[model samples]
Target: MNKIDYKSPIGLIEIEGSAEAVRSILFVERDEIVNTIHHETPEVLVDCLNQLDEYFRGERHVFTFPYHFEGTDFQQTVWNALTTIPYAETGSYKDIAVSIKNEKAVRAVGTANGKNKLSIVIPCHRIIGANGKLTGYAGGLWRKEWLLQHERTFNK
Candidate 1:
């Protein structure tokens, strides 16, 4: 995967990935590729760029590209639950734990959300505090709010 740069409203994004799939996407002030697994072009990367563009424009609410994120089994379980969060809907850490049949794993659910690598594609923004307050996010809370607002504005 080679590093790629994407211009977004917030800033330029740096993502690492291979020809078959994307591994990660990071926002930065300038071009800085890291941990890229360079792969064939016009295939995996082409679709990634297209979806990313649509997402930034609020024209896309879901992603359908192939990704290869690595994580612990528990983390993957929590991340999988995140995908079930409706496009513009929100959920609590407790809600996730219940969905996964681990009703007592609220703290673990929060940890899983904190470790999510797919970011917007996984819709981690939809997760909030139990009281509905915005909580942790790898992308920063401001970005989370922005994403949720972006979804709400277009989802209707």
Candidate 2:
């Protein structure tokens, strides 16, 4: 997969994918070693970068780029439900589990959320704890809060 780096409000983010589909958008920790660099931006990546720029600027609410999700069926279902969460809105793990028609799978929903690799595009940051507290995020809780606040700015 091709990879490009963008400096975001939270930190440097690595967007990885192919010419046809975006694979992952990850937050890169400060001082993290990056061994791969593809300076050339394919059309798809350029589009992804543009959308991310719009998102950070509070000018966009939805993503239109194609993304490739490689995961188990349950994980993909969870990720799909994550996308259904509107911008600036949040859902609980239990909410997601129930939406998927497996209300007893709340913990499994959280686990699947942790496995989402698409970051902002997949909108896993929109998932919160049942108590309405911010919860586990692959990008870190701080980044998750930042993303939620970022969307809130536009939603209101």
Per-residue accuracy of model 2 over 120-148 as CA lDDT, tens digit each? 98988999888989988988898999898
The TM-score measured for candidate 2 stands at 0.92
Off by over 4 Å in 2: 31-40
Which candidate comes out best when scored by lDDT? Answer: 2
How far out, in Å, is residue 89 in model 1?
1.0
Clash pairs for candidate 2: none
Span of 10 residues, lowest total lDDT, candidate 1: 33-42
Candidate 1 per-residue lDDT, tens place, 1-156, comes to: 556666666666666677677887666656443323335453666677678889888788879988876898988888888999988899999999999999999998888788776667777789998898999877678887888888888896
lDDT of 2: 0.86
Clashing pairs in 1: 1-17, 1-36, 1-37, 1-38, 2-38, 19-39, 19-40
Local distance difference test, candidate 1: 0.78
For each predicted model, how many residue pairs clash, with residues at least 3 apart or on different chains? 7, 0
TM for every model, in the order presented, reads 0.87, 0.92
